[model samples]
Target chain A: MNVLVYGAGQLAQMMYLAGAPLNLNVLAVDVANKTVVHPVEKTVLPQSLEQAINDADVLTVEFEHVPEELLLVAEESGKLSPNLQSILVGADRVREKHLLESLNIANCEHEIITDIAQLDGICERLGEKIIFKSSRDGYDGYGQWRSSTAADLPELKNIFTKLDLHKVPIVAEKMCPFTRELSLLGARNESGEIVVYPLAQNTHHEGQLHTSIAPAPLLSEALQAQALDIFTRLAEKLEYVGVLAVELFEHDGVLLVNELAPRVHNSGHWSMHGADTCQFENHLRAVCALPLGSTEHGPAAAMINIIGCNTFSKNFLSISGVHFHWYGKTVREKRKMGHINVTANSYADLADKFGNLSEYLPMEFFPKLLADADRIK
Target chain B: MNVLVYGAGQLAQMMYLAGAPLNLNVLAVDVANKTVVHPVEKTVLPQSLEQAINDADVLTVEFEHVPEELLLVAEESGKLSPNLQSILVGADRVREKHLLESLNIANCEHEIITDIAQLDGICERLGEKIIFKSSRDGYDGYGQWRSSTAADLPELKNIFTKLDLHKVPIVAEKMCPFTRELSLLGARNESGEIVVYPLAQNTHHEGQLHTSIAPAPLLSEALQAQALDIFTRLAEKLEYVGVLAVELFEHDGVLLVNELAPRVHNSGHWSMHGADTCQFENHLRAVCALPLGSTEHGPAAAMINIIGCNTFSKNFLSISGVHFHWYGKTVREKRKMGHINVTANSYADLADKFGNLSEYLPMEFFPKLLADADRIK
Candidate 1:
């Protein structure tokens, strides 16, 4: 079967790799250039995007922010998986929050602010400390504003006015005092068969994902059940197909929905080495309506992002279980160039290898690893 | 760095898949058309083979049978790994045998026969039971003949005459009574760092590899040492870089070298899932002069080739540890369409999963699995 993926980026490149062994032809559309690039070979050839999409048996997206016009064209073909609605919900923070609230799912207290005037009463109602995120086109902490205290609200209001918050609006959320961040990745097929990956503990740096560890060490059954429950409710409610990542905040023992990513996610990259089947492959399988593979986890696994740096020595492979995945992209500041996934027989072994990995990478890129090393030990 | 692979076949496709995550551009040249095909995308675009070769930082081959002219060009560029001589030795049975003997590696008693008359006294000289293989362009069970008894010699001689055996010549070997077939895959970098995967027990059907189990069940340390010793000697002698697979025959307690594959071999497919570093990635690493990854094996693993069939249900993935690799080839008689690799915490778990996989595959293609089920139990 052939699959056409919207957005020719690293995720698409990875999906292309995972699909090859499954006998699936994965083609990527360069949304920016209106051309197609071979995900693995990266060869820009003379082929019309329309012709490629017309030839594909299935259409999917690697990122939620795919152009709406392209998505409408794919939707007309009736091949797009997880549907346009699900992707739209993931793209717009306001819609996502509304969907969660409709299902009575536990989520951070928030209000949609379309006008600067609406921001006046938001802090009084929710809290003084809040994070304001663009309802659309926001990622990696971009298009976001934070109010540390009531004193900072007027300054934030002024900035919002300058940015014309009336058009795009902003999701003002009361910052929850969560102990740690976690993400749950789940795949649902057209047949409604759902499989969820183990919860992964995630750490972010400068608003970008820095590291993730699967089976989230010291996780309790109660917390896992809560996260999976939230994932299932959202997946079934949306009639979702393919992989969906729900970023959550673990506040005390309860889990609250933080955001949703309607695609294979970076936090689940460890599954490439740590699970029986990875999220990329599973996502493809789901989109193609193939039987989902097992989501069984290995003993212990961690993924460290190779952000904005491609100069790390390939000598990192000398460290056992360290599997490097360079995205074959030109390095840019704060961009995810690639990632490294490491698996071990035990948590202690994973920690030891991760510690060794920290030594190989620049300290600036591995703050999460440096901090987690001690906790893991 | 870019890698130009000489053959655009399944092995090259796999190499392409493995290299993408390493930030390496892996391009394949179609020797017949003198064009380049993206391995994952399979797009036959307009590009000159010479231009691709010129753009590549390193040049390698997916098989040993690359045309001599291309090898000469790559050798002239000083970018070929394993070098032209090593590949040439791998392609020619006579040269391979000579090299083995020069290294004093234990091998089946053999002689080079150029004429039918040379085969006259070979049966008497070597033994009654023997096998004849073409000196070049042989793979799987093709270009091979076997004699069961002394009475069969005249018919074999007649067949060889019809086949014009004198042109390519043949290597006649006394068949060794062996307990089982085993293979060792090892990689040597340009910097002289070598790492070897665990020995794998291989089973063949009608001379085509059917299945392979790694860390070869009940393996003795002495046998592993012997296999590694032979591999090191051959690799060092050839000054080989990249992965080399040595097929061996376990006769009584001794391991006899059966053949050498200068590139990745079918028996090492299990490494895709069973080893910390797969043969394809390590091969790329060695060729690119990057540090070789560890060769640590998972507890137990098995790989079954999906030969001449693509009709098997992908539902087999529901079985834990079952990983399918479809080569994206048009199915044809005796063609290796794809393979499945499975790993488990123990041999018994692997055996159980293998047994389950056999049920999902056609009986015609899985005789080895059926037989192994009982042995594993």
Candidate 2:
């Protein structure tokens, strides 16, 4: 069996590992070069984009930001997953909000701002503080604007005045005081058989995910079920296959959808070693119309992202229950270097063992910083 | 972190998976090639064999057949695990019998046949039914002679007369009836932490394993404890690091050691998905002087081997909860092609699922014809 993954990134590399043992040949398309190559085979081939797509049993994307024309071509060939509609909604915040509203799913209340007047109306209807976001090219805290007070709204709106509203619309949402952030990673097969992994509690720094703990320290069973329900409804509505990670905000025991990532997610990285079958392998199975895998969690798992560092100690090599994954990228600059997964018999034990991991991490960016910054507590 | 593995095969490939993530570089030196390479990086560079030994934090093997010279080098390096004494015993039937006899471990009572005329004397000291085996280069029912009747002894003697018995001595032992075959996959770290996975009931045909069932159905707790005790003693006695698989034979209420593999064994493959930390990952951790991983089992799992034959249906792809792993080897008659792992809520459920597996298998060489195989009861 052959599969054509639309993007050449870490996720595609991981998917290659999961696909290789099953004798599934995966060709990663470097869209920038329009050349197809096998990651493990390391073969550079002279195949046209159309020919590659036609040869694949299925076509999928690693990220949502693929060229729309290529996606249209894939859809025409009857191989694209989650469909163009789902990708469009995920790509555009306005369409995402509309879809959630149409499905009666509870999300952060927001307004679509196409003009300065629309921003004023949104502020009048909502509150003094809001988050203004560009409809496209935004991730990891980029392409965003913030209004902390009513006095700041006019200035923020003025900055967007020169842009075409239709081409670059702004979405303003109410800022909620949430208790915690959680994510649900689940997979829905073509037959609608959905399996949800244990909810994960994620901690972020500077809008970038630094760590995630599985089974979420101390979440209520009720809240976990509610989160699963939200993800299930979204997957069914989208007619989705493969893994879906739904990021949620917990405010006063109530869960609200923050965003949805319709592919293998960072929050699910622990599943690679902490679950019966990893999310990547299972996602491949789901997309290929194969059987779904068990979603049971391991004893306890914690995954730490190794970001912005090129070199690390070989000492970590001797750490117990530690598994390292390095993306074979040559250059590294705040690019997600790789990840470290640690599993233990108990959550506290795992935390205790990995608590001092950052200290051992080569501090290229902030040398001699206080030890507290390196601690996991 | 650096590690030296003795054999380079699929198990080494998997241990590579566990080590690659932690930046723990494992150098596997194939006895045949005398060449070492990183399985994940897939890079080949030359280093002094002794230098590779010196670089490792700890040393272990994928199998026990590593040449004695290499074992001595690692032992002299102070990193060889399971010790050279134990490995030598594992590699040669002569030392194995001597060690077993010294430890008072029960086995097929035998006499060393250094001369052809000794067969009659050996038969008299042992029993009427006897099995003869070469001291080295014997595995999977190869390089052995079986004598079930007196009529066979003359032919066996004549065959041995054609060769030099002094150069290649053989062990002749009494044959005993066994109720079933079983194995224990266990681990020991330098710190003396010991973990034993559930005993597996194995079925082999022509000496090659065909299937393995975890928690062997209807097994008594006493039997399980006996197996664990035997493994613990062997590990401690050898000062073993990394995983060890002890194959045994059950004759009535007593279990006797059949052979010992001082590394990851095929019977333990189910642990890749059935346990919290797979044997490959745990083996690396154990050898690297890291904490051992949990040996907890999943609900239930059964792994079936896919031996030689390239024409099997991909339909196993349709079975939910089934995982297929194919080794990338040039196809050959009776070679290990791949395996399929089936997991379910219960063993009965897994057996039921195995019923449909034949549909995806190459039926020509299937053990039973369809009519007889259909009768599961």
Candidate 3:
């Protein structure tokens, strides 16, 4: 079975690794160049984009931001999974928020702002603090402005006025002061079978995921059920055919939907070592229409990202259950060089591994390593 | 780092899959054509074997039977792990027997037959029941004959007389009555550190491996210690720097060496899903001079070989903890198509899974599947 993924990046590379054992030939398209390539080596294969698509048993995306033109070509082939509508919803925050509201899903109070003037009564209606984000991708996407206090509103409004919000709408959401950020990752097959991993508590540094603890320590039964219910509703509605990640915020024992990622998300990467079936394998299983693997409960696992640093010794692998994954990409500021997955029997054990791991890494880059380790208890 | 593996077979393909996550680029040398190729796809790469060897940081072999000329080229690179002597010993049963005798290791009582005349009193010295195997691999190799009683000695001698026994000597050993067959797989690093996985009980049918159960049920501490001691002695004596497997026959409470596989062996395939650190990864880590991964014991695992068959339904994967591994190879009579790994918390649980898996498999092809499952308890 040949699975062609739209993005030639880490997730696709990981899927390639996972798929090999199952006899699934996973190829990646460098959407930037529109050329089919080997997922891990990134070497150009002797096949045009169209030919690769024609050869693929299933078509999927590693990221939702794949160009609309290319997605159309894939969608027209009738092989793409999760379909175009689901991917677009993940790409456009406005559409995402609308879907959440229509489903009666609990999410932050928000509104689509096409003009800067709409900021007027926003504070009185929603809250004093609000974050504005571009609804689509590219430099225009993930673009953000925050009105944390009354004094900051003038500068935020001035920054927003330069953009034509009509062309690319912005979603203004009242920032919830949540206790912790968590995410539930699950896969839905063509047969409508769904398997969700335990929620993973996330910690971000400078807006990038820094650490994730799976089956997040101190998980309440209610929170677990709520997360699964939310995923079930959204996936069934979209007819999602691969792994979907729903980012959540926990505030006062209540869960709120924060974002949705249509494809494999970074927060689920820990499943590579944490779960019986990693998300990458489950995603391929779901997309390729194979029997879904079990996501059975296992030991506590922590995934710590190796961002923008590559000079450390890998001697830390001597520690039991530590897996080092380097992407083999060039070093650049804030680039995800690789990640280290540490599996332990208990939260305290995971914390100890982190403390041991912190000693080997360049401490400055992993500023939150020790902190997150201590938080596990 | 690039690892150039000799012999583009399933073993090399597995190594490629295991090496990718560690940022190791693994390529295979098609010794049959003296060309470099992708291990899994078997596609000819755009590089000469010489160039591949030049570019490789480490060189290893998937099968010890690789042509001596190719082994010479690989050994000349000064990067081969397990070294030339270790590989040679594995290829020649005569050398293997000598090494075993030199170390005072208990193996089958054997006699080296260089000429038919040597068999005159062989039956009297060893036993009436004897099995002879070619000392090397080739058309004229693995040539075997068995003499069960006094009446069969004349025919066996007549068959032996037709061979150029001097050029290709044969090892004639008295077949021993054994209760069980087990193998210990372990890795020795360049640092001389050794780690061994729990022994896997193996069952063979028609001279091909049919099934294996890891940490063989009802294992005694003494048996485990004996196997470990055997591995450590051989590895340290050879100064081995890769995974080595020792096949053993257990009689009463004693283990006698049966054979040595210089590279990863079929019995160890269970480690892929059963052990915390699989044998392939540990082999790559050893040859690459990386820290050896932990081989801490875990759940019992069973590996059932799919042989000469490709018509089974994969729905058996619906059973929890069942991992199906297909090698993507064209099936041939008696060829290993792939393997299925089933992990469970105990022997009884493993037996139950085997019962479920047997339903999805072609029972005719797996003659011992149900019987072995019953034996597990």
Residues B176-241 of candidate 3 have per-residue lDDT tens digits of 999999999999999998999988899999899999898988889899999999999999999999
DockQ, prediction 3: 0.82
Model 1, stretches more than 4 Å misplaced?
A41-45, A115-117, A138-142, A160-167, B115-121, B138-142, B158-167
Best by TM-score: 3
Query: Model 1 Cα displacement at A216 (Å)?
Result: 1.4
Highest DockQ among the candidates is held by which one?
A: 3
lDDT of 2 by residue, B167-210 (tens): 66788877867887888999898899888888887878777888
| Structure candidate 1, residue pairs in collision | A326-B21
Scored by lDDT, the top model is 3
List model 1 lDDT by residue over A1-377, tens digit each.
88989988889988988998988888888888878877765666567998888789999999999888888998899999979999999999988989999999999999888877888777789898899889998433338878888999878877777766556778989999999999999899999988999899998888999889898988888888888889889999999999999999988788899999999999999999888789999999899988898888877899999888777677778887788888777889888888989988888888898888877888776778868766677
* Model 3 stretches with alpha carbons more than 4 Å out: A139-142, B139-142
lDDT tens string, model 3, A55-89? 99899999999999999999999999979999999
Error of 2 at B91 (Å): 3.0
| Candidate 2: tens digits of C-alpha lDDT, residues A1-377 | 67888778778878878886777666787777767875533346678887999899988877877777777888898887767777777777888888789888888888887776787566677787798888777333337878878899777766777667777677888987797788999988888888888988787766777677787877678988898889888989999888888888888889888888878889889888777678888788778877688777765787777778767654564455676777756656667878878776676666665645645776544232222223323
Among all windows of ten consecutive residues in candidate 3 chain A, which has the lowest summed lDDT?
Answer: A139-148
Q: What share of the true interface contacts does candidate 1 keep?
A: 0.85
Candidate 1 docking band: medium
Predicted candidate 1, C-alpha RMSD: 2.7
